[model samples]
Target: MWSGDELDLDAYLERIGLRENPLAPGELRADLATLYAVHRAHTAAITFESLDVLLGRPVALDVKSIEGKLVHGRRGGYCYEQNSLLAAALERIGFEVTGRGARNRTRGDSLLAVTHAVLVVTVDGEEWLCDAGFGHQGPREPVPLGRPGADVEQGKWTYRIREEEDGVLALCLLRGDTWRDLYAFSPQRYHPVDYVVLNHYSSGHPHSSFVGRVIVQRPGDDVRRALVGRELTSLHPDGRIERRLVGPDEILTVLDREFGLRLPDREAEELVGMYLAGD
Candidate 1:
């Protein structure tokens, strides 16, 4: 059930260019799934970068700020910004969405509030987990919760979900015979402030990857590419990076050309110089 206070349905429908209200419960199940797919494609198509931090600007988490980035022809964002916008969209389309916190497996079990925003949907007497954030590990479709084993696909990857203690859930990928942890969460409710605190850490913590690295990723009609600290790799439909880059000079060109990212002149110079120094 959606209320005007929780979601601006008109604005959300307009944002997605859907003429009818999507959040009407009966139609919401499929509509919400469609919205998640739209968000995943939208986020994947746009490259992630910390250019805002580089420009000495703080990232905004509101709907206007989020819609502007996606619609106003600007760069895509990291998890917090990406997932928040998706949550708003879901709410407007008539899905019951509440913000929740997840302990990122990569960042260790730190319980950092709601660093990620995920959608919980009730369909046919069951709840499901829907996430279009998490970059490489983002869920392409909603995975059924309360299930012993469930499979969800995003791009070329398949994720498996397993039940944990109490209501907590663990999501992982099947790596041959072994499972790899991506992240874990529960149905715990959270507020916007939770995301605010985590976003602050993600952008400011010295040990955080975003603070120390320049990462950008984009997907074309046929290929998806990522640039991490001067190395660029383009993956094909077969999940192979046909081209592997080795220098900063190439990274700059790829950021601008491949990802539509505009780096500051000084930052570009510093990166190129650092790459040349072989550090």
Candidate 2:
């Protein structure tokens, strides 16, 4: 339900790291394909993290803050915040978009208790899956839901989509003849509150990964991530894994130099101290 006044094409494009806005549905010579391509490239370069929360600056789950944190700053954002804002943008651009509930297929078989939000867009009689909040790098390009073997790029990850029973779709990564399930989602329209509840659990739950640890991931030609108290791992396009041991102080340096993330003086020191103390 995005109106013209709320849809600022320039700001949206800039937030996603596009130099110029691409043609969207019903626009001048709109090309949904290229638009999808551009978005995918842009999203891969950024990451999604709860660094703000861990740093004691929790952002409210609202439109303006979501737009500023996710799009304006061009930083990584969680599902509800990222997808909701993107959906609003697509709507303004004249795309027939719908919000869908998604489940962490990697977690297990659970259908009723969905935990993620994704977008399905129909342009020129084709359905494309648009997910911008999956991670630092996920499929930014729209995936054709009808094809048998469709691959989309998200950073260095190649997401392959295949058909499943009951008209559901299974999305996996093609790695050495193996398809790893990242998640599965249906094109069911979800309400705003549906996302709010999930977002709360993801951000606040004690056992949730975000609440317990610090993580920052960026999908490059080589994907890299730093997990607190764990070895830093980098996944190359050729399937080679590079690992490094990071210390407490190194974390702060990496955060500033590598991720472009700046922490408050005291907060940065505390994060270092916490890891050093193994607390």
Candidate 3:
């Protein structure tokens, strides 16, 4: 039996706004279209956030808690939690999914923490890279792995990828005339135990920004919305930017309205207080 029995697959899909499975029960195919649909729905419905870490609570990466937090609890999480939830759902729907880690060059140019997580999904002998935890600047949909595309801004910021030496692939962000490296990873799969260690450092270590800050993001077709502490930003595809400062009292309101999350009032207050406390 699929591990999905531990989670309400129907409810999880519903939570992600997929009212009904486009592919039938036994007819589900692990094709690019299906991957794209699920990837898009997940990024749109479930947010990429670090609320639990900011609250100093242990972030759970197990399938059960990941499903519970995103589905019934109406919560969001960072890389480990978000991708775990997506991996579970995809596996239940007949996809061959393997967890992979990226050296998060976006945060720092070091590989000390292989922090970012992405799923390597095989469909018809081709591996597709799928990620739902990359907050605002991640791929808007599943992209073909190894055979990276360039200047492909389909409801996402401009990004490109290239094959690197030693069997690793590098994903980059197009910044003006320069392409800045965002992350690098090989196709080697990761186990759940690896995430446990990384999650500890990401949520507890003093140098990790996730520990003491408020960060939440959800991506859309025309724009991206994110909250870093009191600041709210709306990034448009047409080179337009909109920014605002959200007050502490209204943090919960913004999270719910813009990010599609409804955390408890008390927990919301605590997270906001920690963010306002500053480093």
Number of the top lDDT candidate:
3
The 10 consecutive residues of candidate 3 with the worst lDDT sum are 21-30
Query: Which consecutive 10 residues in model 2 have the weakest lDDT in total?
Result: 21-30
**lDDT accuracy of residue 158 in candidate 3:** 74
Give the candidates in order of lDDT, highest first.
3, 2, 1
Best by TM-score: 3
Candidates in order have lDDT scores of: 0.62, 0.64, 0.77
Instruction: Give a tens-digit lDDT track for model 1, residues 28-74.
Output: 44454565544554454555565555334587777677666654545
What is the alpha-carbon lDDT for the whole of candidate 3? 0.77
RMSD of each: 5.0, 3.6, 2.6
Q: Given candidate 3, what's the lDDT at residue 53? A: 85
Local error of candidate 3 at residue 157 (angstroms) = 3.9
Better of 1 and 2 by TM-score: 2
Off by over 4 Å in 3: 21-27, 107-112, 149-153, 175-178, 238-241, 275-279
